[model samples]
Target: MKQLIVIGAGQGGLSAAIYAKLKGWDVLVLEGREQSGGKAGGIVQGDYLLDPGPSIIILPRLYEAVFAAAGRKMSDYLVFDKLPTISRIYFEGSPPLDLPGTREECLRTLKEIAPQDYRGIQDLLRKLGSVAPLVDKTVFSRPYLTSKDMLDPGLLQFGLRFNPLRNYRQMVDRWVTSPLLRAFFYGFPSYGGQTWNSKAPGAFLIPYYMIEDGVYFPRGGVRAIPAAFEKLAKELGVEFRYNSKVNEVLGNESKATGVRLTTGEVISAHAVVSNADKLSLLTPRDGDPGWEPSFSYFTCHWGISKTIQGLDHHVLVIPKNFETGFEELYDKRTFPTNPIVYLNAVGALDPLAQPPGKTLLFSVVTAPAEVKGIHWEESKWNYVKSVKSELRSAGIEWCEDDEEFQRIQTPSTFAQRDGNYRGSLYGPDEPHRLMGLFPLGNRDAKWDNLTFCGGSVQPGAGLPMVTLSGKFAVDLLSTR
Candidate 1:
C-alpha cells in the first residue's frame, strides 16, 4: 500500500482516512487535539455533557453515504433521531413561531401566524423547490477545479432554474412579507458566516433542508459523529496519533513528501492531505484573490437545574434590529451589541446530556475574528453579559444558584486550543458573484501531492460540506 499522511482528525480528516484506507493506502491521521471532531466535539461538566461546537445536524444522508461507500452500515455505528420541530424562532413583541420538519407542517404554521401572507409563503416554497434541485444535483456533489468548472452544464441548469440576477435577500423579499418572517429568513446566510445580502446561491437551500429533510440529533451527542468515523477508520487499519501536531509539510518544489511533527519526528508519505485551515499551512500568492475571515462564535454552555417551558430543542432569538446586528458582525467587524442568539438544548434527545430534572443550554453569538481596536481578552466578559441579557429577554430566566456549570468559549479560545486561525468557524464567506460561488479547489495546482479539505476549501463549510470535502480530496488524489 502507498503511504498517505493526513493532518488533523476532524470530520474531513477522518472521512479522508476511511476512504484512503479503502483505496488500499497506508493512512495515518495526525491530530493536535486530545481527540477527534475538531470544533464538533463535546465537553463534560460534572454530570452534563454539552456539544458547544456544531449543535445542529441538518443532513444525515451525507454521513450515511460515507459509511455505505466504505461497505458499512451507518445505523450500526451511529443512531440519529430526526427532529419534528426544526427550530422555534422568537422575535421581539411577536408570538414565537415553530418551524416544523416537513414543508406542509411549516406552511400550516406560517398560514396560522400570518393569514394575509399565506399566498406569498406558497410562492416562496415554490421558488425554493425550483432552486433546490440544482443545489442537490450540482453544487453539493462536486468540487470546482478550474474556472471552466463554472461552465459545467449542471451549473447552467442551476442558473436557469433560479434568478441569476437577484441576490439572496432580494429573492427572499419577493415573497416573504411579514417583518418577523423576513427577519427569520435573513438569518440563513449566517450558517456560512455570510450576510443576508450576499449573492451566494446555495444559502437558499438551508431553510429548505431544515424544513423539508428535517434537523437531527445523534443518539450520544454531536461527538458521536466523529467517534463513529474514527471507529471506522481504526477498524480499516488507519492509524491516528492524537496530540501529535504536524509542524510543517515537507515537500520539494513540485510535490509534497510528508510532514515533520512538533516533537522533531519526521514521517514521509507519497501524498499529504491537510485538513487544517489553509491559512495555517499555505500562504497566498500575490495575484491570488483575498477574502475576509468568516464570523466566529462566542459560546456559553450552561448546566441548569431545570428546563424552560415553551422552548424547543433549537431556538433563535432574533433581535429587534436584525440588520444592524449583522452589520456589526460582518461589516463593522465587532461584537453584535444586539446579537441574534441561537440557543439549543439536547436533553430531550439524549438524557445523558444533562442530569435528571436538569437541562443544558448551549448558546452561540456571532463575533468577528479580530474586533477593531478591541482585544477579546478584555472584552469577552462584556459579550457574555450581553448574551445573558438577551437570553433573559427571550424568557430563559435562570438563577446563578441553580447553575451547576458554566463555561465560555470565544474565537480566541479556538485559536489557542484548536489552532484555528483567528478562531474562524468557516474559512471565508462565499463570494456573491456567480464566479465567486466557486470556492478554492481541494488540490493545489502548483503542488501535485498536496491537497486541502475541511471548511476552508472547496464545497465550503458546515458539517456535511466538510465531510464531502474529505471525500473530494481523496477522489482528486486517486484520479491523479
Candidate 2:
C-alpha cells in the first residue's frame, strides 16, 4: 500500500483523506488548527454556533453521492433540513424580492417586482438552463490538457446560446434594466472572488447551482460536513494530528517529497497533497524558493442577539452601488466603501445556532487584497461602522448602534496564523479539469510520484469537487 500524507485538514483536506482511505491507501492528515475544515470552520460561543466561513451549503444532492463513495451514507453521519426560502434581494429602492427555490417561483417573483425586467430574467434563465448541462459535460467533466483542447463544437454552440463574449456584466446589462434584478444576477460573482465586469458569463451555472440544486443547512453547522469527513476517514484508518502546522514543502532536485513543519520536524512521504491554500505553500523565504502563492481575503464572523427575519437561510444583499462597489475592493486597497453584504441565517432551520429569541447571522463583505497589520485597528472599526451604516441606509435593521457581538479578521492575521499566500483564505484559484486547469490522469496529476489535491489543485475548491480531486490523486497513485 502507498502511504499518503495530506497537509491541512480543511474540508478539502479531510475529504481528500476520506476518499484516499476508501481507495485502501494508508492515509495521514496533518492540520494546523485543532479541527478540520480550514476556512470552512465552526466555533461555539455560549449559545451561538458560528461558522467561521461557508455559512450554508447549497445543492443537497451532491452530498449523498460523495458520502456513499467513501463507504458511508449522509444520513448515517449527518442530518440537515431544507430551506423554504433561499434569498432576499434588495437593490437601490425597489420593493425587496424574496427568491423561492423553484424556477417558476423565481420567475414569478421577478415578474411581480420588476415587470419590465421579467422577460430578460426569463430569457437569461432559459439560456442558462439550455446550456448548463453542456457546460457540466464539456467544460466541468473533462480535464483540460491544453488550449488546443478547448476547441469543442459543443462549446461553440453553447456559447452562442448565452452571448458568450459579452461577459456576465454585459449580459446582465442587456437583460435586466432594473438595478434590483441586475444586482440579483451579478451578486453571484462573489463565489469565486471575481469582479462582475471581468467575470466570464460561463459562471451562469452558479444560478443553476443555486436554484436547481437547492440550498441546505446541516443540523449542526457548515462545519458538520468536514467533521463527518473526519469521522469517515478515521474509520478507514486515516491518522489526524491537529496543531501540527507545516511551514515548507520539502524536496530534492526534481520534485516534492514531503513537508517541513514549524516544530522543526521533516516528515517524509511518498506523496504530499496540500489542503491548505495553494498560494500559502509558495511563500518565498529570505534565502530562496520555487513558485509563490497568490491572493488574499478578510473574513469576519459575528454572533447576533436577534433573529434576522427578513433574510432566508441564505441571503446575499447587494450594495446600492454594485459597479463602484467592486472597483473599491479590487483597486482601492481598502474595504468596500459600500460593501455587498451576504447574510446566512442557518439558525432558521438549525435552531441550535443561537439561544432562544437569538439568531446567528454570518454577514460578510469583500476587502482588498492589500492587507497590512499596521492600520488594521482602524480598518476593523471602520468595517463594522460601514456594514451597519449600509444596512440602515437601505432600511434593513437587526442590531442596535451599540450591539457588540462582532469580530473582524484581516488577511494579515490569516498570514500570521497560517502562512497564506497573499493571505488568500482559499488558494490561488480553483482548478477545473474540463478547463484543463488540472490535468494528470486519475485527476491526472502532472508530477510523477507526487500529486497536488485540495483547494488549489485540480477540480478546485468547495467540498464535493475537492473530494473528486482526492479521488483523482489516488487513481494516479495506483498506476505508479
Candidate 3:
C-alpha cells in the first residue's frame, strides 16, 4: 500500500489523514502535543473545562461536509448546538447590542437600538446574502495558482459581490453610520488577522454566516470537535503518534522522502504533508527577516467562583476608540494597551464546562506575532489589566483572588508548546493586496511529494477552511 506521513495532527492534518485513508493509502499522523486540535485544544483545570482558543464556531456545515465526504454523519460522532444569542457586543458608553441568530430577530434588535438604520440593515443583509455564494464558490472552494486564475470567466458571476475598490471598513460604512455597529461589523476581518482596511473580497459574508447560517458550540466542549475527527480517523485505520516532533523533512534535491523525528527516528513515506507553520518549514534555521509574522493571541483563562450575569456564550468588548487601537496594533506594531477583548463563557452554554454557579472565562486579545523588541513576560500584566478593565466596563467580573484557577498564554508560551514561528496563531498576516489574498499553494512547486495544509496554506485559517485545506492537499497529491 502507498504510505503517507503527515506532520502535526491539527484539524488540517487529521482531515488530510482521513482523506488519504479513504483513498486507500496507509496514513500516519505525528503530533508533538499529547493531544490533537492545535490551537483549538482544550485545557481542564480542576472543575473547569476551558477552551483556550477558537471559542466561536461558525460555518458548521463545512465540518459536516468533511464527515459526509467520508460517508458518515457528523452527528453520529459529535453533537453541535446552535446558539440563540450568537454574540453580545459591549461598546464603551453605549447601549449593548445582543445579536440573535436569525435575520428577523437581528432586524428587530436593530429596530429597537438604531431605528433609523433598520432599513439599511435589511439592505446590507440582502447584499451579504447575494454575495455569500459567490465568495464561497469563487475563492473559498478553488485554489489560485496563477494570475490567469483570476480571469476565469466564472469569476464574472461574483459580479459586484466583491467590488474590488472598497476596503472592508468602507463596505460596512455604506450600510451604517453608528460607530457601535460599525465596530461590530469591522471586527470580522480580525477573524483572519486582517484589519478593517483589508481589501480582501468576501469578508462581508462573515456577518451573513454568523447571523444567518448561525453560530454553534459543541455539546461537551470545543475540544469535542477535534476529538470526533480523531476518533473517525482512527476507525478508518489511520495511525497517530503523540509526543513525536518532526525535526526535519527528509528530502532529495527534487522531492520529499519522509520526516525525521526529534527523537532520531526516520519514517519513510510516499509523500509528506506538513501542518506546521509554513515559515518553520521554509527557514529551517534562522527565519527570513522580510516575512512579516501573523497575529498571535494573548489569552487569559479564568475559572471564577461565581457566574457572570448579562453575558452571552460569546461576548466582545469593543474599545471605545477602535481606530486608535487598530493604529497602535497594526501600524505601530505594539501590544494593544487598550485592546478589544473577546470573552467566551462557554459554561453558560455547556454545563460540562464548569462546576455549577461558577463561570469559565476564556478571554482573547489579538496581538502582533513575536518579534525582537516586544517582551511578553513583562507586558502580560498590562494585557491582564486591559482585559480586566474592559470586562468590568462591560459588566463582567473576575478577580485573581476569587478565581478557582487561572492561567495565561502568551505568544512565547505558544511558541514553546507548538513551535509556531513567533507564536503566530495563523501562518502569516492576511495580505492587503488583491493579488496576495490567495495564500501559498497546497502543493510545493519544486518538490513533487511535498504538500502543506493548515492555516498557513491556501483556503486560509478557521476550523472550516483548515479542514477543507486538508482535502485540497489530498486532492492535489492524488492527481499527481
Candidate 4:
C-alpha cells in the first residue's frame, strides 16, 4: 500500500486523509495542536462551550458529499438543523431587519423594510441563481493550475454571466439602492478576505446561498462539523498524531518525499499533502506573484449572566458611519472606529451552549491583518472597550459585572495558535491575489507529489469550501 502523510488536522487535512485512504493510500495526519478541527475548534470554560470560528453553516451538501463518497450516511455522524431566522441585520437608528430562512420570507422582509429595493434584490438573486450551476461546474469543481486554466472556455462562459473583473460594490450597487442592503452586501467580500473594491463578484453567491439554501447549524456546535470528519476518518483507518508539528517539506526541486517535524524527526511517504497555509509552504513563482496579506478578525467571547432579547443565533450590526468604516478597514489599513460587528449567540439555538441561565456570545469585528506599529498587546483592551460600546448602542448591553468570563483572540493569537500567515482568516489580499477570484492551486508547481488543501488553496475558504478542497487534493494525486 502506498503511504501518504498529511500535515495539519484541519478540515482540509482531515478531508484529504479520508479521501486518500478511500483511494487505497495509507494515511497519517500530523497536527500541531492537541486535537483536530484547526480554526473550527472550540474552547471550554467551565460549563460553557464557545465556538470561536465559523458560526454560520451554508451549503451543507458539500459536507454530506464527503460521507457519501465513503459510502456512509452523514446523519449517522453529524446532525444539522436548518435555522429559520438566518440573521437579524441591525442598523443604528433604524428598525432591525430580520432575514428568515426562506426566499419568500426574505422577500417579504425586504418589501416591509426597503420596498424600493425589493425588486432589485429579487432580480439579483434570480440572475445569480440562474448562473450558480455554471459556477459550480467551472469554478468550484476544478483547480486553476496555470494561467491558461483561468482562460478556460467553461470559466469564460461563467465570467460572461457574472463578470469577475467588476468589484463587489459595483455588482451590489448595480442592484440595491438602499444603504442597508448595500451595507449587508459590502460585508460578504470580507468573508473571503477581500474588500469592497475587490474584483470578486463571486462574493454575491454568499447571500444567495444563505437566503436560498437556508443557513444550517450542527447539533453540537461548529466544532461538531470537524469532529464528524475526524470520526469518519478514524473509522476508515486513517491515523492521527497530535502535537507533531511539521517544520518543513522534505524533497528536492522536482518532487516532495515527506515532511520534517519540529522535533527533527523525518517521516517518508509516497506523497505529501499540506493543509497549512499555502504561503507558508511554497514561494512565489513566475506568473504567481507573492500575495499581500488580507484582513483578519478580532473576536471577543463573553459568557454573560443573562440572555439578551431580540438577539438571534446570528446578528450583523451595521454602524451608522458604515461607509467610513469600510474606507478605514480596507484603504487606511486601520481598525474601524465604528466597525461592522457580527454576533453569534449559540445559546439562542443550542440550549446547552452555556451554563444554566447564562448566554455565550462570540462577537467578531473585521480588522486588518497584523502589520508593523499596530501593537495589539497594548491596544487590544481599549479596542475591546470600543467594541463593547458599539454593542451597547445596538441594544445588547453587558457590563464588566455581567461577564462570567471574557476571552479575546487577536491576529497575534491566530498567528501563534493556528500558524496562520499574518493571522489572516482568509489567505491573500485582493490587489496581489494569486488568482483573481479563485484560490491557489492544490498541486504544487515546485514539488510534483505535493498538494495543498486549505483556505489558502483552491476553492477558497469557509467550512464547505475547505472540505471540498480535500477532495481536490486527493484528485490531483489520483490523476498524477
Give the distance in Å from residue 435's predicted Cα in candidate 3 to where it truly belongs.
1.7
lDDT: worst 10-residue window of model 3:
428-437
lDDT per residue for candidate 2 within 99-170, as digits (tens), equals 886666766776887799878777777778788778656644543445675677776677667554566678
lDDT per residue for candidate 1 within 151-170, as digits (tens), equals 87877776776677887778
Q: After superposition, how far is residue 330 of candidate 1 from its true place, in Å?
A: 3.3
Cα lDDT tens digits for candidate 4, 1-480? 998999999999999999999999999999998999998987778789878788989989989989999999999999999999889888989987788898788889888888998888888888888878877887678888787778887677766786666677888888888888888888888878778888777788898999889999999989999999999999999999999998888887687888889899999999999998877655322242445678788999998888767688899888888999999887788888888889998785676788778888888998987866688888899889878888888898866788989999998887778877777767767644555566667888778788989887778888988998898999998897
lDDT of each: 0.80, 0.64, 0.80, 0.85
Candidate 2 error regions (>4 Å): 142-145, 148-164, 284-297, 306-311, 330-334, 371-377, 398-404, 429-447, 476-480
Which pairs in model 3 have colliding backbones?
none
Whose TM-score is higher: candidate 2's or candidate 4's?
A: 4
Candidate 3 wrongly placed segments (more than 4 Å): 285-289, 430-434
Error of 3 at 287 (Å): 5.5
TM-score of every candidate: 0.94, 0.86, 0.95, 0.96
Consecutive 10-residue window with the lowest summed lDDT within model 2: 436-445
Which scores greater on lDDT, model 2 or model 4? 4
Candidates in descending TM-score order: 4, 3, 1, 2
Model 4, backbone clash pairs (residues 3+ apart or across chains), number: 0
